[model samples]
Target: MPPSLPPRRKSNTGVIVTVTLVAVLAVVGALTTVLVVMDDKKSNSVADSGYNYESQAPTPTRTYDPGPSSEAITPTQPPSAASSTPRATTRTTTTSTPSGPRPVLKTKDNPLFLGENGTNVVTCNLPKWQSTPTAAQAFFTAALPCLEAAWQPVMQRANLPYQRPKLVFPSGKRWSSGCGDVTEGEAAAFYCPPDGAIYMPFEGLNVQANKNMIGSYLSVFAHEFGHHIQALSGAMKAAYQQAYEVGPDTAAGLEISRREELQAQCFSGMWFAAAWNGKGSITDTVVRDMLEDGYQRGDDNNPSAPRDHGKRQNYGAWQKQGYEKNRTYQCNTYLAPASSVS
Candidate 1:
């Protein structure tokens, strides 16, 4: 219009300007989006239910303790010793003296610690296992009765009532649980407190662990089942309440988890050792196999992994403590030094 450039040239200049503006706006929008997302991530708390895994796997239905800090809490009354624990805490950390398989019934003052021997020689009649889910279920089924036989006497002496924990063998590539959803191989086996059952997904247990070796898997099962035992005793509840006070993901919080897990390991070892001593299938060779396999089952070796379970070395050591020592009192993980648990 001002008699400057040709019409075609002017039109081309306008198009270039339009494209430049659009590009500038796009860059600005992208930057703004990134900033917003970063801010949101920074603001999210651990209690947000955004995080998935927990130390209490089979994972506890994460009831975030939005309450007082661990140090601030006082111990409360526990459930009836024999009654089913209400969606209570599950796991261990601490050691009590193990009364040799036949010791005087302990007192309320001398509560029956995990490893204190109650009665002697109850053999678990377990079959050699196969890698299939059905076989695994059968193996656990057979083994549990033995555990009940082994542990009931201990509880009775303590005046604690014993209740059998329900068992579930999830049968699918993908499954949902009271704790959360599962992808193949995401969980090994867990004692979920919410449902009061032990979930050992045959597929999940077999994910890198299924060698048709009964002792190897049995070691883990006994540990989780030890959790069930802990639930039965007031010990499991006390441990959880302690953990809640400390904070589940924090260092102290993690120690509590490690202690709980390690104690369970000790309890399992005691069971196996007790079985080995009797007419049971747990041989020294089986114990050796389980110890070797346990190196792989440690829960918190990686940096990103939640520090719920102990190191691989500790896993072996704690389990060996129970098997070798075979004293229930020695199974107390809480009394051990921090380095021992860590």
Candidate 2:
């Protein structure tokens, strides 16, 4: 009577049910995988918004070892026996020769060092000649203090302290500076932050003067001092940092250097403004002459030569901007438009 009873029940129902369950599971896994891929793509699309993937490579860090300390420098003899006398008196003598205009002698008060006034007056005595090493040192000393004075208020306004830098006057032959050894021919001017000092070889000033280029001498000091301003204002560190990130030869790197240099020229102008206002002695002719000389030395158009500094036109424009505006903000070549720098 129901031979069917045995087999009908156990028929293939169980096998079919097992197979259907397995197939449903497989389909669900495929859908899960597709959903996961879609979510990943959506996340990446959001992350890449407004970013140039190709050009946004990570910047490399720059490693630098601090340079050596400044060598011990001995003070040289003064132009006359003035070194021996205490409370020294400086006289300004004007001599009119067959030449167009003679150099004007200006006396500078003794420098105040380490909160002590005139401690090193004997060593700070300037030579008789305006272009002499003594004179250059004296000029630098005077200008250095003035620069500090000018920047002090500005820095203080920004809640920054004034850090004074040491000035080193080296002779022509061979001298040791914070940066390293410098020879007579290589004797331009430079600031070494590692040593916190500025190095100026008397021979460099003399050479420029002999070439009828005394203006270049002033510009050199201005440039070196400009470096000092950078050190104090954190501008120098920022520039180096930028250069390290962008590479020294890139457009950004060049812009950093140009900004520093142009600011120095502006500082030079500030000095002139102070001199003009206080003494009423710095004539427009003198400023023009100095500016022209600075331009000549700064010519960067010579592609064969090193274009790290700037061109003559660039120097002139920067100087003029500083002289006219007398404001630090205005002299900011880095932030200014290209047309302004040009």
RMSD of each: 24.9, 34.4
Which regions of candidate 1 fall more than 4 Å away from where they truly are?
1-110, 114-119, 207-209
Candidate 2: segments with Cα more than 4 A from true spot: 1-129, 207-216, 299-301, 339-342
Clash number for each model: 21, 1
Candidate lDDT (C-alpha), each: 0.48, 0.38
Which candidate number maximizes lDDT? 1
CA lDDT, candidate 2, residue 20: 7
Q: Residue 96 deviation, candidate 2, in Å?
A: 60
What digit string (tens of lDDT, one per residue) describes model 2 on residues 219-274?
Answer: 55555555565565555655556665797567666555544554555555544443
Candidate 1, 83-146: lDDT as tens digits: 5222222234545533232222221212455223432355566777777778778888988887
Error of 1 at 99 (Å): 26
